[model samples]
Target: TVPGIGPVYTAGIVAEIGDISRFKNHNALAKFAGLTWRQHQSSKFSAEDIPLTRSGNYYLRYYLIEAA
Candidate 1:
């Protein structure tokens, strides 16, 4: 069970909520992977270049990354 994945990769996967389908497209997925440019605005709201949405399953993400 141990010595499977590392931390960063695990965190990245966990940060992604649901299946890859949840992403509108490949670009979206890449964005979540922090492999693309950061979005600073959404319509009328402005956001920072922070990581994935914290509203996501944090425990899962943390554990994922930890395991990774």
Candidate 2:
């Protein structure tokens, strides 16, 4: 077993993300999964309590949090 990666979840994640290579890097992957936190910036002053955007693959996000 791979830590928290249950067989069923692994299958679902892999099936959802057909081509991992489509993502350029880890940041891209996280963004696709909706795991990246949002940011609000203005002339070098940034907000820290911004919320996460709901514009990504929810299925992938579920698996990611489960794995964590």
Candidate 3:
């Protein structure tokens, strides 16, 4: 989810950020990969409280989804 990150580079990052727990929480880890929330809960988004900008680590998400 790193903005402007290339595939090769992303692979390296995933290799390095092995123990993601090194980050405090999901939000903190999400921010590291530039995957944070955006947008506001306006009248249109009232149904949804918070919306995250797809800025989370895609690799992490992918692996978890696959493993699950």
**TM-scores for all predictions:** 0.31, 0.85, 0.37
In the predicted model 1, the residue pairs found to clash are 5-68, 6-68, 7-68, 11-65
Local error of candidate 3 at 55, Å?
Answer: 1.9
Runs of candidate 3 with Cα error greater than 4 angstroms are 1-16, 19-21, 30-39, 43-45, 49-52
lDDT of each: 0.58, 0.87, 0.63
Candidate 1, which segments miss by more than 4 Å at Cα?
1-17, 38-68
When 1 and 2 are scored with TM-score, the better candidate is 2
Ranking by TM-score: 2, 3, 1
Worst 10 residues of 2 by lDDT: 46-55
Residue range with the least summed lDDT across 10 consecutive positions in model 3: 59-68
**Model 2 / residue 26 / CA error / Å:** 1.2
lDDT of 2 by residue, 1-68 (tens): 68889898999889878799999999998899998887789999999888888769999888877888
| Candidate 1 C-alpha lDDT tens digits along 1-68 | 24876665565555555576788987665545444444578789987555554443455545555665
For TM-score, candidate 2 versus 3, the one ahead is 2
lDDT of 2 at 8: 88
Which pairs of residues have clashing backbones in candidate 3?
A: 35-55, 35-56
